[model samples]
Target: MKIVIISLLAISLHLTNSQITSGIVSDFVRTNLIGYPLIHEPKTWIFDPDVALKRRKQFVDLHGDKGEKLIERLGLGIDGNYEERLAEQRKRDEGHLGGLNAHLP
Candidate 1:
């Protein structure tokens, strides 16, 4: 098929013209792995989360209590005590996990 030929051509060209760079890998990450554009004009996930999240708080809202474990599983941030953070956040939210609203006290 024409699509296959195009892919083969692209791969061949890529191999000849460039070494494996982060941007090239980032392009693949953004395109196929994560399916999210390079937000902030940068940053890409190495593997697919397989879900769409438009806003930061949508993470917990989408996954519920499992959200904390999900962050651990996905390596979403620096290695730290995520469970502790969640517990603290819950106390602040009165045991509810919701989106942030800086305007509210």
Candidate 2:
């Protein structure tokens, strides 16, 4: 009975030690060898312009005027002309693609 308990405790300690070592090795490889990993969904502000612009559009749509304030506070690295840029796009659409109203009636 005592022998079995000691063996079980030893096995548990061994397993815990292996898990800790594995975690340390994994972190070392990711940090020293991998270096920053690849970008994916949700996106960050490191160097993705498309993500930043898309986030701006979504944010403005959701928050309206306050959205711009939050965007400024966050410093999303855009041209800071969301309204002007959209207006220009609309103007271009009107001139070239006949605008969004062309499909009406």
Candidate 3:
């Protein structure tokens, strides 16, 4: 009976720890969305844009220019400039997609 209880407690702790770790990861990603958009972060699966945008102001204030540069380096964005660049990239992507489709089996 004692052994069974200890095993259960250990299993519960393992599961709880996993959940906590994932939660922190989610929060981190959520808070950094704008800095890392669809192509940039590519961790949309982990951090949705909504959650990220929700904390945008806080993130900017905390990280400032250094943060902005980090996001840019990560392929994310600082703001309007990123959008413009992304738009241009999308156009280029579409052109490439069109070429690839032409050769598809």
**Per-residue lDDT tens digits of candidate 1, residues 12-100?**
57675455544565576577657865444665668756444545467666655567667544543556776776676566767343555
Model 3 earns a TM-score of: 0.21
What is the TM-score of each predicted model, taking all chains together? 0.21, 0.22, 0.21
C-alpha RMSD values across all candidates? 17.4, 15.4, 20.1
Candidate 2: pairs in clash: none
Task: Name the best candidate (by TM-score).
Answer: 2
Candidate 1 local Cα displacement, residue 5, angstroms = 34
- Per residue, candidate 3 scores C-alpha lDDT tens digits across 1-105 of 686557556655676687775665555555654343545654435657698778888877776745854554456456648777867756766846633654566
Candidate 1 versus truth, CA RMSD in Å, comes to 17.4
Residue-level lDDT of model 2, residues 1-105, one tens digit each, is: 686557555655676687775666566557765664553236656676688767876777776656655754444346787667666665677734434556565
lDDT of 3 at 78: 60
Select the stronger candidate by TM-score from 1 and 2.
2
Model 1 residue runs over 4 Å out of place are: 1-76, 95-105
Score each candidate by Cα lDDT. Answer: 0.60, 0.61, 0.61
What shift in Å separates residue 2 of candidate 1 from its native position after superposition?
Answer: 34
After TM-score superposition, the amount by which residue 75's alpha carbon in candidate 1 deviates from its true location, in angstroms, is 11
Kindly report which residue pairs in candidate 1 clash with one another. Answer: none
